[model samples]
Target: MKSISFPFLYLCTLTAASSVASGNHGLYDVRPFTISLSDGVPRMLERIRDTELPDAISQYPGNEAGISLETLKAFRNQWLVDFDWFKEEESLNRYHHFTAKIENLDVHFIHEKSNEPDAIPLILYHGWPGSFLEFIPLIKKLTQKAKTSTGKHVSFDVIVPSLPGFAFSSAPGANWTVDDSARVFNTLMTKVLGYKAYAVHGTDWGTGVAWGQFDGFNTSARAAHFAMLPFLPLTPEQLEAQNITLNAPLEQFEEQRYVDWSATGSGYFIEEGSKPNDIGLVLYDNPMGQLVWIGEKYIEWSDPKAGTSPSVLTHNEILRIISLYYLTKSILTSGYIYFQNPLGQTGFRYNYTRARTDAPMLFSAFKYNVHYWPRALAETVGNLVLYRNHDFGGHFPGLDNPPALIEDIREIGSYWE
Candidate 1:
């Protein structure tokens, strides 16, 4: 693999300063900011907890369908009684946080540095119904020196950004695509933070942003890693043309996954991509609606075995995830991401011509993920370097299986030469 020239990435870094007037320049006034609850937000939330949630829960008892009413009530009760948002905020604020003006919007991110001079810079992007909070658990692990499989100690200066239209960050104006996010994020790393060359990892919508950095800004985005790839698996016709074959077990698993997703999992995609605003309006102020919509995915998409386990996200963890959306009143803006980059009814139809990246890319395939792409098909999108398959874990691997994900990331960082 070719490397970025030192002149392109590092020459400007030494001289770059924060604060540029209306341009993709260095981050200005990057200071510590707390996650303050919006005005009237606490009162509204209390009203919902004391009155609305119980009425909603009582109206639909015994789980006819959707989020189990009993389970939701239990979660709501814990959120009201036990879960302390202030305490959690304090824990979240333990890491360094900052906001940068890029593309006329303030992008919020956590920049945790490693003491090791040789540490590589790695930016992590989170996807829809997810936030930078997803990457919080991995911050300490990634920033500290860790022993890789090859017994080499590696550390990273980690940056986790709240994507535009997500918590704390400014939303895009109109028709904002993932490419726009990629461009701004590239600016964040090179122009703002003065890191000429850095690695990136993403999941869900984040994969699109990661691909954007890899393809649109290759000079600055040195290497890429993905739990989710830019493109989907090949069709039977394409698979046959390539003369690639899958064994009985692999074929069965792929077939079942496709069947299951097509039958049940595709509704959210269609609704969000087509009429995002319509749904957004309905759920904007309705905290229960927002919780049911987003929280259901949190439960359904995760590893079935990860029941109230810290190894995976706990009940409080899941509640905090939804609460962030509610508190920010960003549920509407956040859903617009799907409309901006519509995957459409038929999945895997992304324009492959545009899926070009020269940077070396690594993919870690978690078995229980929503979509599964064979290694052969995944290589067509980028300069494929490493692909590893894990026995356990699902969609949100950063939170679901931090140890394995961190190890895989460290292994890829070893190939930075």
Candidate 2:
């Protein structure tokens, strides 16, 4: 492995008096920032090399049970021998980065403008375990002008922000909910960035924030797109009453997968939502521990063919995410949203009366996602104008299938009024 640097990341600071005048509510001066995980890499490498593992338990042929002991050993060996943090840092810094004061937090984001005259203002939101990094691959693709189906040339001024407490963004208060994030982000777009109207795309917990924008800020947030839906679907009986027929074989498979996930894979959801502090504190300074906790999700929730191909997320991609969390010292604060809005209690229920029918909505359903809702049932959640089903991707579509996700987002732009 290459020699590790000492200091982790360096931020170019701007004095408050020079950056923002007294009582100015807009962004305090969007300036260039660089990431150079200098100091943290050596310590993280030492920890990875010294990690202790227990004897492997006898199990099935594949990693169906969980991350096999062999997999863990391989990951450790890769970190010690092949993985390069500085190289990854350089790749990350290729995109322009900046930070601005929004609602008392230094919100970090990547703002890339298009040369096209009529470029659209679009914001992409990432969920937990994902940072602004997930959308980096899509920035160039989106910023270039391309013709839409209706002969309209469309390009975007893309804005990818780190959700509060995720990467470079400051952590939120304990009582913060997705609604609070929605308000702050809306302010970032309409007030700080001076965009009167914008569109949005979200996945995972980001879907919740996008929902808030659709429901509450519909005037400014004109159109929205989601890779995941935040609300639950109607029961089978309810769907039957509405004369909706589900494809039997596919429904069976989806149901079984959902049941299996709820039974075996919801432990993290329970822990993170109920006791975020415990897990967050335990893994705060432990790089290997963060890897195990987040790596399992990247492996299981992604497409089955992820690691075998470059198109989908690979082990190296997973390592980069874990490294980001560890170096930022944000593992603890990142889980705070789970505590603020318990999954089952707040956003999980199905309610027809409270749907976001104000704005035009689009959805891209990756077949392997842990949860599933047929287009028939999904359309009821909002004014769903487009629902495209994809057979190749999974939870993190931005990484699992960037080309497909990019196309879907462009299609949404065509539908934007």
Candidate 3:
């Protein structure tokens, strides 16, 4: 793979109160950055256009077997002809993009402050096969004042940070864990950005970071919300021992879905956790390979009804995310999180006592999520003030169903104070 570098110039200055001088251990000056990929876009496009694809094999219709050959061909055609990276770049630059040195890493984030008087600070964390790009649409909505369930108007000073080693954020060392990420982010909010208290929302691996914040910085992380939880839930026998009645039908459905996913859809998990370097090196220079590696999850793990009716997770949306991963060349480091904390192995262990947090928590469970636990089981994990279930969304709720996610976040905000 050819070497790629981002030609970014610090364009704007921030208040002294919000940043420290350069060379300090704390947040070095928060400087605005622009995304530039001109150096490698031509080669990336050529690769996409010239790539060879095998004949379409249809043992079963649609994506039942895997990401269909038809899907790959369509995406390739769109990338070569219709997709415009510059236009996407312009759209992203509409918001404020900045990076501050935290823990010796250039932590990239989109920090949009609300003008509303009652606006609160909120930090969003994105997980693997995802980046800060996932929350672009949601960030705009969140920064605007909206009425909550209690009729109180609220807006947010939204902070969307690229997880270390995921987009613009500097990659961490081999031993770094989500707990380390939680500490740095907590410092980003409290020390660098100067927020006395803040709220948090997370999805995928971000869920683990949020859990760490909830467990460690309960005071400053005043309120918490999650679209996904990382801990394995208690077994049926364990729940029965606690006198918690299972919603039998729903449990049966979720169990079957889990079984099917474990059987077929979790190969990426195992590979990423066990041998990230192998797959990362293969996909690093291969744009189509990266597309298949990440795009397949966006298709299979999202609402099946997406791209119909309301039209979410469109071709452009998926392509933009893939492009970010390719252009940034962070695909290899992004998978390192899996190697550091392999779920269902040495990752987070479920302990009701340890999981409990004083901060109020809200959970929004989208039915199409790849993994699930009943509301009864989720409640025991934290101070779960609200657990809302949705029939129409998936792992990527921000794109699959923005309105529902927006509503849930606002509802959780009402519980913040």
Compared with the true structure, all predictions reach lDDT values of 0.74, 0.77, 0.80
Assess candidate 3 and give its lDDT.
0.80
lDDT of 2 by residue, 99-183 (tens): 6677777788787777776777888999888888888879998989887656677888888999999988889877888888999
Query: What's the TM for model 2?
Result: 0.89
Which is superior by TM-score, 1 or 3?
3
Q: Rank the candidates by TM-score, best first.
A: 3, 2, 1
Best by TM-score: 3
Q: Which prediction has more favorable lDDT, 1 or 3?
A: 3
TM-score of each: 0.86, 0.89, 0.90
Worst 10 residues of 3 by lDDT: 1-10
Q: Residue-wise lDDT of candidate 1 within 305-404, one digit each (tens)? A: 6543435577888878887887877899998888877563222245454345566888887766777766776777777888887656677888777877
Which residue pairs collide, candidate 1? 26-192
Model 1: number of clashes? 1
User: Ten-residue segment with the worst summed lDDT in candidate 1?
Assistant: 17-26
